[model samples]
Target: MIYQKQECNGALYQMCLYSMGTMPGMSPRQRAGRRRTTEKAKQEINRRQRKWRLMQLINANFVSGRDLFVCLTYAPEASRARALEKFHAKMKKAYAKIGLTYKYIAVTEEHDMDGEPVRLHHHLILSGAHGVQLAEVVRDCWASGLADVRTLREGADFFEDTAIYLLKEDCHKGKGARRYSTSRNLTPPAEPVRLRLGEEEEAEVPPGVKIIEHVQNANEFGRYEVMVGRIYNQAAFSAWWAAQRRKAAPDPWERLRRRRQRKV
Candidate 1:
């Protein structure tokens, strides 16, 4: 029985390493190589997910016809967080005087140069019909530096090209700080619709939708993509995501056991 228990433990250890893309017989160098590769893959996935989430938020909230894009910058010596807070306060007061209620999504970023200090700035998408007035108010309100505001062009791909441009600077900043924020009134992304395809059945493509590009075996699950822009089945996707989370969740007792082992 003792010998059987030892064998089982060894088998479990080997299985765990195998699942992690390593094996029992790997040399130290091979193990290290695999570890680096795994870490790189994880980082790439995380980066993609962050970009996707940012795009979703922008698509859900921003209206091309109603909202204006504004870039707000601060002086080289200004504290970014404090300047942003003050800017928001001033904007609220200014909008109130004009009798306009507004919704906005703002992203803060710092441009890192070779020798100079990082230059902090903000990109905002503000919802209102008065583009010129809004621009004038923002320019006057932001005393620290320049404010550049413009109307979002009709039929322009704000969710794709514009969002990518605005977020590219700060997306790589990691999880230490929020890359973007929005007014409480902004609408959240709708839940995605979940659809499970059989091994042979192709994923549904709505009529008249152009396929921008296709990716085969994009990830571990052999995912594919058809760029229908912001028109995908959100409800289906959300349900599928929730199901995956439940499937991947660890047993509570197993988590407790691991915690106790770590304590020991």
Candidate 2:
């Protein structure tokens, strides 16, 4: 789990991530190497999911057209100036092939990634009437000799309004390919609460929070929180809180670092 630094109330909070693994069918050596790769990918996926959830919480009506949020990282051996230029060129060619006219963002940084030379790639924001296909975009990159592309739909309103959830490092610093990193202010004044999840009619009280028995359903979201105070469903709250825990946990490497620090 890689944790990004986010700012909250003038304090830094760590943002967790889950990465996706490599595709199936490979030799033993390839399998071993890819297992580690898959773990990293899984961590990234988890991170993005959390970010998406945070965005949904803050901005409910946000729509992310067809723009692609492309994030990539490369092996350290390819970090040289010439290799970097080639990689950049490859990315441009791939985008052109895919007919991406929206936005392209990239970032190449030297970081200690699993003891390997890691070059943080870029983040792309693309827009087109036909919309882009995620799988096809990745295929094109591999075909064009660029690193495998991992992109997602990053809503403008989602990323901007939920700025509080973003890593402080990603806010003003680190740039490769970016067109519009901010979104217009459109967050609603209040958040809608899901009083009743599905067919469960019985109200549940979240641990550490109170539930007003009379609030029945979402139709009275704001009414209850105000009249009867904040209501929390025990099950829903527990699940969400558990998810938060997984996100907040440190990666294996970070754990080792902590252990070393304690020993010293």
Top-lDDT candidate index:
1
Pick out the ten consecutive residues of candidate 1 with the lowest summed lDDT: 1-10
Best by TM-score: 1
Q: Which residue ranges in model 2 land beyond 4 Å of their true spot?
A: 1-65, 82-85, 94-102, 109-121, 128-131, 138-151, 154-157, 161-167, 170-264
Candidate lDDT (C-alpha), each: 0.55, 0.37
How does model 2 fare in lDDT?
0.37
Question: In candidate 2, what are the lDDT values of residues 1-264, reduced to their tens digit?
Answer: 111222111111112212223334656776565566545444444444345344443333323554444444445454444544454456556667757432332333433423344444443333323345554544444332344444344444335432332332333433453322332332322322222122222223334344221211122111111111132344554565455445454666998999999999
In order, what is each prediction's RMSD in angstroms?
11.3, 19.0
What lDDT tens digits, residue by residue, belong to model 1 across residues 1-264? 000000001001000001125556778886776666556545544454456556566666666666788888877765565777777788888777777766777877665433234667788887666443577888887888889988865354435566666666653565776777878876665433333334344443333233342332333322233232222454554454455445443556998999999999
TM-score of 1: 0.60
Runs in model 1 lying further than 4 Å from the true structure: 1-49, 76-81, 112-118, 154-158, 196-201, 218-227, 230-264
Instruction: Quote each prediction's TM-score.
Output: 0.60, 0.29
Clashes of 1: 13
